[model samples]
Target: MDPATLIGIALAFIIVVVVNVMEGGNPMAMILIPPMLLVFGGTLVICLAGGTMGDAKLAMQGMVKAFTSPAPSAAQLVPELVTLADKARREGLLALEDYVADLDDPFLVKALTMAIDGTDPEELRDILEAEVHAKKAETKQAAKFWTAAGGYAPTIGIVGTVMGLIHVLEQLAQPEKLGHLIAGAFVATLWGVLSANALFLPLGARITRLGELEVAQMELVIEGVGALQAGSNPRLVAQRLRSLLPASQREEEAA
Candidate 1:
């Protein structure tokens, strides 16, 4: 699981609760049903209307995958690619076929399968590049579902705030209860803003980040498969693949 995602969410909630308590504010005062239903329900209504049901499902699945699935370890893939490069250079592209069934990553399997089938180097690049772009586009659409919700949330909160103000004005003759009514009305605004920033906005940002990581890993596959097809030396292939990583992660490959 993604510790950072979990920790960030937990910390946000903890800080808010602690501060509320420390300030002598009633933590329960924030729990109003109407404002919450308006912000959350309204956001979902617009998001679903804007995108397909499949897109909404994918977005939820994407969020779960982001938190639960570990990214492919490129450090491990480097060695595997080096081994493939050496075997291909020694025994030809067809020799790599022996390892294809054993490969776990479907992307790698497809790219290497094409290479073994004697696909032209440029054609191989085009095929893999197209797949990469298609996958990236799909993932991006999933993220847009959440981002659209995030964009709508704050504005929806303002609508709730206005509704609350209207309720307050309707009972304006009761001067003694005006302060309480005003505070209750503002609670809708709080729910909207907090839910947007704390939940939807952050969820969208994390989905985008996870998409970038996934695309980078797939690009590495393209490079690895290309190098194997080109008959580059094993060590040189390893070096080239290692260059795709950030400087900090590159050090782990060295070790």
Candidate 2:
């Protein structure tokens, strides 16, 4: 599980609840069913109308990924690529074939398989780059769905607030109920802004960041495979892959 994503959401809710308690406000004031339906249900409508049903489904999946998907690290990959390069250089391209079946990452396996099969380097690069681009595009579109939801939620909440006020106005003659009615009406606005900032927006950003990290890892794999296929020195392959890591991480790894 992603601790950052989990802790961020938990912290947001905890802060709101604690502040409400300190202010002598009802702890349950934020839980009105009508406002929730208006904000969340209306967000669904907006999301569906803006994109295809497939995109909506992918966006939901992306949210789950944002919280649970473990990102691939270049640091871990560098050693694997270096070892493959050494084996290929010591024996031959055919020697790498045996190791392919033992690999867990399908992407790396496919790249190595193509190299062993005598695929042209240019053709290989094209295929891998296209696949990477398409995958990133799909992930990006999924993130955009959440971004649209965040943008629409606040407006939908305001709409609900207006609707509630219209109902409150009808009870104007009953002055004793006016204050309670107005406070209840504002709950819709609260639901909209809170959900937008705390949930939808953060989820979108997380998905996007995850997508970028995935693409970066794939790109590193492509370069590593290219080096191995070219029969480059193992240290050269390791150096090229290490460039993908941050300066601080590079230093630590070297140490």
Candidate 3:
């Protein structure tokens, strides 16, 4: 799990709930149950019913990918790529075929296999870059789906509020139910705002970033492996890969 994302959300929600409860709002008013059902559950059912199961599943898969994947640190790939490059140089390119079988990353394996087999460098780059682009497109599709949901939610919330107001107006003959009806109506708006900022937007950005990082690392494998095949020195591979790293990370190691 991403410690920052998970912990920040938990701490913020706890603070919000505690503060609002102390402010004398109904304790159950802070309850996430009914609003969550209306916002998330209802939206999910509506989306699935509309035949966007693939999009919905991709959204959930994004969360799973983020949670399960421990991203390679910025400079982490350097040492590994250097070692692989050295091995490629010492042993003939055909030696990489043996290592390829041991590789777990499909992208890296595919890239190295192409390089070792003496495929044209441009063709290899094209094939790998195309895969990277396609993965990015898939990531964007998933992020866009959730972002679209975020956009729809506030309007849906407003619609829900209007529906609630309609119910409240029906009770205008009885002054007793007026306050409760109004409170329930406003819950819809609250659900909309909270869900947008707290959930959808953050999730979309997180997943998109994860996809980008994965693709970048794969591209590194592509570049470094290509260099290795072309007889570039391992030190040069390390230097080239370092250029792709974040400045902060580069600074940390420089220290």
Candidate 4:
């Protein structure tokens, strides 16, 4: 599992608590149960209401993926593609069938299998590209769910704050308790804004970024597979695939 998201979220909350204490506020005061439920629970149901059940399922999966999915490494695949290109060049595309089970990436395996089975290069490209497009659409929907939640969270928080303020107003006769009650009322607003910036929005962006990375990796595989099917030189295949990577990764590969 990727630790960056976990570490980042934990650090954000820690810093918030630390800063609250540094400002002479009791961190526990911000932990009001009513506001917590209103802000978080309300936001959740509202987001769910906005989307279908399938979208909700995708969003939950995306949330897990954001915290756990490893970043794709297209750089690593280049050498493997180059190796396949070399074998196909030396022994023909049929020779690659012997190596299919040894390949780890299902995407690469599928591409290589198709190539070895005498799939026309154009048809293979079309099929793989279609699959990539479908994946992009699915991931896009998942990320959209989180992005919608992030947008709704702050508004829900404000609603919670307003409700709390209504309750505070009812106790106006008790001037002695006004200050504490007012502070508690504002906790809804704090949680709303804090959760939006620190949690919901970040998760949405992370999911979007991960989707993009996966798509990029798949695109690289498509190019690699195309080169292999064409029986391109291993050196040319490596150069072509490396060109598709970031300059930093290309430099690392060269080293």
**Largest TM-score belongs to which candidate?**
4
Give the per-residue lDDT digits (tens) of candidate 2, residues 62-170.
9889888876555667788899999999999899888999988788899999999999999999999999999899889999999988999999999999998998999
The positional error of residue 40 in candidate 3, measured at the CA in angstroms, is 2.0
Q: For model 2, what is the error of residue 251's alpha carbon versus the real structure, in angstroms, after optimal superposition?
A: 4.4
Q: State the lDDT of candidate 3 residue by residue for 1-255, as single tens digits.
A: 556556555676677678878888875764556555677766656655654678778878876775566765546566767888888888878877777887767788888877877899999989998998989988987777667667766766777678789999999999999998898888887777767776677667777888877887777788887888787798898888888878876775355
Off by over 4 Å in 1: none
Clashes of each: 0, 0, 0, 0
Clashes of 3: 0
Full-model lDDT, candidate 3: 0.75
Candidate 4 — which residues are off by over 4 angstroms?
A: none
Alpha-carbon TM-score of each model against the true structure: 0.91, 0.96, 0.89, 0.96
lDDT of each: 0.83, 0.89, 0.75, 0.89
Candidate 2 ranges beyond 4 A from true positions:
251-255
RMSD of each: 1.9, 1.4, 2.4, 1.2
- Candidate 1, run of 10 with poorest lDDT: 66-75
- 1-255: candidate 1 lDDT, tens digit per residue: 666766787788778889989999888888888888998999888899998899989888977876777655566677778898899999998887879999988888999988888889999899889988988887888878878888888889888888888888888788888887788788777777777777777777888787777778788888988888888988899889998988866887778
Please state the error at residue 11 of candidate 3 in Å.
3.1
